[model samples]
Target chain A: MTDAVKISNRNFSVFYGAIQALRGITLDVLAHQILGIIGPAGSGKTALLRSMNRLNDLNPNCRVEGQILLDGEDIYQPEFDAVRLRKRVGMVFALPVPLPLSLFDNIVYGPRLSGIRARARLNELVERSLQAAFLWDEVKDRLQTSALRLSGGQQQRLCLARVLAMEPEVILLDEPCSGLDPISTSRIEEALMALKSKYTIVLVTNNTKQAARVADTTAFLLQGELVEVGPTDRIFTAPKDQRTNDYVSGRFG
Target chain B: MRIPPRNTQALAVTLLAGATGLTLAVLVFVIVFILGKGLPVISLGFLFDNPQEMGKAGGIFPTLVGTLILPLVAILIALPAGVGTAVYLSEYTGDNLATRIIRFGTDCLAGIPSIIFGLFGFIFFVTTLKMGWCILSGALTLAIMVLPTIIRTAEEAIRAVPAGYREVSCSLGATRWETVLKVVLPNALPGIVTGIMLSIGRCIGETAAVIFTAGASLRLPHSVFDSTRTMAVHFYILAREGISNENAYGTAAVLILSVLLVNSLSYWMMNRFIARRTK
Candidate 1:
């Protein structure tokens, strides 16, 4: 990867009312690289990913201290428009949440909201996004069908295509494959590997093997604190932290 | 293993079945009695002709027209207001003191006696506002009376929408209002329609409120401001005064049939909407 820093957090901490979710931690996400975050439940993995796009802001009592910068700009500044920031950074959730709409409409929903009204352009965007998410061949003939009718895996891929239609700079996936079978999981992993070339991807997963397979760099978080972060191969083979070593080797989460 | 006593369980089952059978029997009895008495008087001339000789000799066509108009006007006014209030309460506000008070106010509104609503309508819409015994006054009264039902049901429906849908919409950079209009409202439509249907039933069956606000007039209403008599009000007057018991039964039968028709239509529409959504 290039030397450019796509996103970086400096001493960032997240609190929900009186309860803190993330401790003061620093990390850098390099441009055009997949950064995998792996941790067990209550480890703040989802919290960290949500904070990147400010999705955590939806919670009324959620508080963020310190800085989270995207392209060297503080995202939590008073004047910063969260709507615009979210447009630049998109998100996918654990379960597939296709809107109650057709597959074509789902892909065009974001674009339509952004004022893209040309039918030809929307059709092209749908095709390109589906192709990128590797869902075109499966769903091309039934583009006008309801998205809810798709299988669990296809629905998840449709969600990826929906986000991709916006042409976001960074994509945040919060356990995107947690609800899928192994074959579906592998399909998504392959999509992630292909996606890293164009967008900076931040993947939070409970499955460590998934991180090892697709992540260029993997960060291990435990109990709201970063245990270690390094090149994926090194982190898996010989982690510097004992906790990371034990966790990666299936000793403990 | 010792077998449990079956006597009490069997008695309980028998009691439940008897209760259900009793309810059904009562419903059938009422329908059969009304249809038997009213069907003889229901003729083409009786249905279409205006009442004459103080509503004792002719049909209830004017009252039927008034009945239809009152509910239509009431629903047109109440639906948007009630649904808007529900959306505000469920989507925009938090569980704060103000929200609690708003909810309490809605519940209170729902429990107020229909007679009290009638008095309020007479004072406010008929006398104070000088609407003066018209369909509009009656409709406005009914609208306020049914607002609570609409608000409660619509709020429940809007709240029932999955939070995941909102999160996904927001992540796609849709604004709060956009998310509500595009995703939330469409999903909650069946519930909203159900509420409206219930309000329609209430408006149609209401007698005391319409009597006070909409004066009993045998003539058909040409405008909203003209005095009118709904079927319920007409039936009550005819039966109470011993003017025409046959016409009263006939009117009651028509009212029941119309209510049933409205209910079935609403349910059919709601089922279609839900089916399309799931598809």
Candidate 2:
């Protein structure tokens, strides 16, 4: 991965009404790297990830202070188009919510909204996206069938394929494999590894093992505060913070 | 052998079953009585022929036509307006004071008496708008009456759509309107159709509102501007005026049959649509 920063948050703080979810957090997310954020519940991992693409703006009471930059540009600027920003940075939620549509249609939904109307192009895009998510082989024969019929793991992968179909530069995943079985989780991890060459990935996971397995860089957040961030091996083997060492070693959350 | 104490639960169950049986018996008896009295008078000649001697001697063909037309026009006016309001209230707005007030207003509208709506329609459509005592005026009145039902039901349906769909759509960069149009509406369609079916039933049976806005003219309406009478109004006048209880019973039977037919057809269509969607 290049050392070029794709997204940077400087003194970023988030508040849901009066309750602050994320304290002042400053971090640089480099291009083409998997930045795994390991945190316990209520550590603001989701807030930080959502703030990158302005998804937190959906909450009326959510307030953001400080700058979140995407590709060296302020994403929270008055003139920044959220719709366009979202197109550049896509997200997959914890629960796999496949649009109540056909498998083919779900993949094409993003492109169709962006006005890609050509049949041949959409067909090519759907195939490529599903392949990237490692779902093509399983669903190729029944692309027209309802996406809801897929297994839980396949649904999660389908969601990943949906984001990939948008041709986004970055992907934000919020505990994407939290509900998946080990086999499904491994498949998703494998897909992410293959996907890192083309897309920057930010994964917020409660499972430290998942971070260890897939991430290049790891950041530990505790109680809305960033305790430490470093290379995965170093963070795992030689954490500087006592809390990180304690949490990673299963002493306490 | 165990001695059973006083079985209060069994007694209560028996009482409840008896009440239910009595209610069903009454309903069946009324239906049977109506059919027996009205069947002989319901010949093709009695059905299709025009009324003679002020609806005392002839068929209710014109009344049947008016009954069909008035409700059709009412549904046409109310469905779009009601569903649109429902979508806006449920989907576009937040749960602020304004939305709460609007919901309150809708509930108040639902509770208002049909007679009051008839009076308002008479003053507004019949006099102020000069629509006259015609089908259009009646339809407009009934539209207002049924609007609340449609709005409430449609709102519930729209709200029942899981919030996850909206989030997913937004994450994919779809605009709010696109998500609503492509996802929300399609998922809420069956419920909306159910609300409309209820509205149709209410429109068919409504007499007070139709009587005030649509004059009891015993003739087929040539246009919306023409005065007409519905089956319910015709039945009411026949029975009240003591002209022919026979024709009144016949009209009642026909109304019930028509309502059954409509309900069955709509349910069948809805089931087919849902089946195809899932398939």
Candidate 3:
């Protein structure tokens, strides 16, 4: 994993209407490594991930009070176009949300939105993205088939492929395998491991063991506050914070 | 004196079944009553030949043409505006006072009587505009009458599109308009079409508004500016004037059949479109 800081959150906070979801979170996600955010329910993990790409801006009640920098530039600046930023920073939601379209159409939605209308170019993207997400072989022959027909795990991976098609520099996953079988989860983990060399990945998950297994760096959040973020090995084995230690040791979520 | 759970369940089931049966019976009875009295009067000659002697002796060819042109023109005028309003209200305008007022306005418009709309069309399009009871005046009136139906149904349809689809589209860098156009609208198509179908039915059956504006001219309409007689108006004049009960029934049958044809055709097209996506 590279030691370069791809993203830096400098005392960021988020509010949904009147409720504070994240409170002064500061962290760095290094390039070419999976940064796993492990937290229990309502710990602001999703809020943090979504805010990076300004997906949270859709909510009329959403408000933010901090800066998240991408490659030394603050993304929250008024001049920073959220639409263009989303193209660079793709996201995979917690549940698989395959659009009611063919597999080919779903993968090319981002590309089409970005004005890549060449037929050959879209076809190439469909193949390569599905391959990168480890879904090409299973669905290679049925690209025109409806995406909703795919199994839950395959659908989630297809969602990942949809992001890949955008050729994004950063890939954010919010509990990508929260509802997957062990084999499916392992397959996703394997794909992520293989993908990190070319993409900066941030994985938000409830499973601590998943973080321990795949993440090079791990951050634990407790009730909307970041307890600590460190190397996964150190965070899991020798954390300096007593709360982190207790949480890692399964004392309580 | 609390009833036992099993007995209550059975009683509830019986009552629900009886209510359903009664509803179905009423619907069937109305359809049968109309078709039974109307079917014997229909003939190919009656359909193709132009009316003679104030709709006493020939076919309703002119009225059929009017029926086709009037609804077509009205739908063309209202569909874009209604759908635009629906999309803007649902996707662009957040929950605010303006949106609420617009929604309430649509509801009020929907609640207004067809006779009232006829009066407005007569006063506004026919008299004030000096359009003189032509197809344009009638169609404009019908368009206003159907706008609320199309807007309300299209809004419901657009809102029914899963919130997740919008999120996915936005996250993939789609602009609000792009998301609405590509994702939300296509998924909402079946519902929008259903709303359109309902509007078409209302336009085909509407007598009050069309009579007030279009002026029951038995002559075939040459253009939007030409005053014409629609199927409903022809039927009303025939039955009311006691011109020919036989011809009136024939027009009624033709009206029923055309509405059915349009409805089934739209449904078939919609089903095929939906099937293609699923496959």
Candidate 4:
């Protein structure tokens, strides 16, 4: 089998009630790589991330016209199940969002919904997923406690674990560590590194140093258009685009 | 911040004291008058015995039971259905025409006059269906009457839950149903329960609707099909019929006391549920 679990979008434009948000933008996501999308506020970074799982579909006024393919399968086909697609392409939000459930339920929730029900198996999956998210030790003794009771950092990790339990092929992180402390940020970076072996990681962040620290590939988005994308080292060290360099150097948004 | 001048502070304090004292005096006078007037006729026999010879009244047992039964039935039907509709509106339904219409309908339902509901119940459940004066008709009427309360309260509660919770569940690849069941409902439960309590209060106190639809049967209702008389209805009948002035006063007092007790109990239950969830 080919190594690529590729995602390609051709001339994709998005509109919200006649107000165009994303201009006709084309992009490709390579497999098994961390793709970092960097953008300022309202530059469409969040919108682009939301589009991958078709979460934008939840908004009645949102309209998207384009061809988006996942490994040669058209994701925008009328028959495509958004729910199933979301399961395959999981997302983590900027805020720490633990469900109003016990931590155990938080981790096992997706797996159970996907039809895994054996008690022993669920417990094991919960443990494994939490460990993968680097939160097992801090939360092991309090697995049955409400997930909301966890500290902010722990809640974010728990959210990551919850997503990991679904075993998605692609994981989307929308500023996952934006709300965390330095230690938690490092832990999240470590978890992302560990996760890259199993899932194609796509991240959106405002932190340039974080992108330099974890991303294998970096793409800068300015005013809803892709400004530049390349290997992270080249993008950070010697970029071909002045806008990309200016953004990294903090010249302007 | 610098303190106000002594005269200004004193004037403010006096004003506050005067207002509070006046309000307290009025409240106390009303309570004392009602109790003083009504207490004389309250007897064990009056509470425990069934109405004798068409409400010559040694008892209010049937009315008390009927009051409890109708409101309980209304709550039993309204709690889940109302909360479910609220969950759909708050968590599932996007801002669309249908959601807007449903919300508008609920709002309009909430404001409709209770007497109109009674007339409606009388026509639909009683005359059209030939159900007659029965607990079923009364309970159904009360259910519709209180539904708007339940839905509005439940909707507010569901809305109060932090959006982060839903987003987290969605991120976990959980379906919308799963998110609502596991995350949203549990968090909003206390609010929903509060709504039910409020609905129960309105249902129990409702005299006009139950009287028209349920009829004034002094017997204990064995089923929904049986006619019943709630405490409020009994109070109204006693006051209107004037079997004796003493009986009317006693029945009114009993009805008031029961309503107070039920409201307090509902408040206590709400606090307990909130504490349990937070703990």
Better of 1 and 4 by DockQ: 1
Cα lDDT tens digits for candidate 4, B137-171: 98889889988899999899889988777776676
Predictions in order: lDDT:
0.92, 0.92, 0.94, 0.85
Cα lDDT over the full model 4:
0.85
DockQ rank order? 3, 1, 2, 4
Give the true-contact fraction for every prediction, in order: 0.69, 0.61, 0.94, 0.47
DockQ of candidate 3 is: 0.88
Q: Which residue pairs collide, candidate 3?
A: none
Model 4 docking tier (incorrect/acceptable/medium/high): acceptable
- Candidate 1 per-residue lDDT, tens place, A149-228, comes to 99999999999999999999999999999999999898888888898889999999999999999999999999889889
Those runs of model 4 whose alpha carbons end farther than 4 Å from true positions after fitting are A1-3, B1-47, B91-102, B244-257, B260-279
Clash pairs of candidate 4?
B49-B59
Q: Which candidate wins on DockQ?
A: 3
Q: Each model's RMSD to truth, in Å?
A: 1.9, 2.6, 1.4, 3.3
Which TM-score does chain B of candidate 4 obtain?
0.87
Candidate 2 residues B134-178, lDDT tens each?
A: 999999999999999999999999999999998888889988898
Q: Candidate 4's error at A35, in angstroms?
A: 1.2
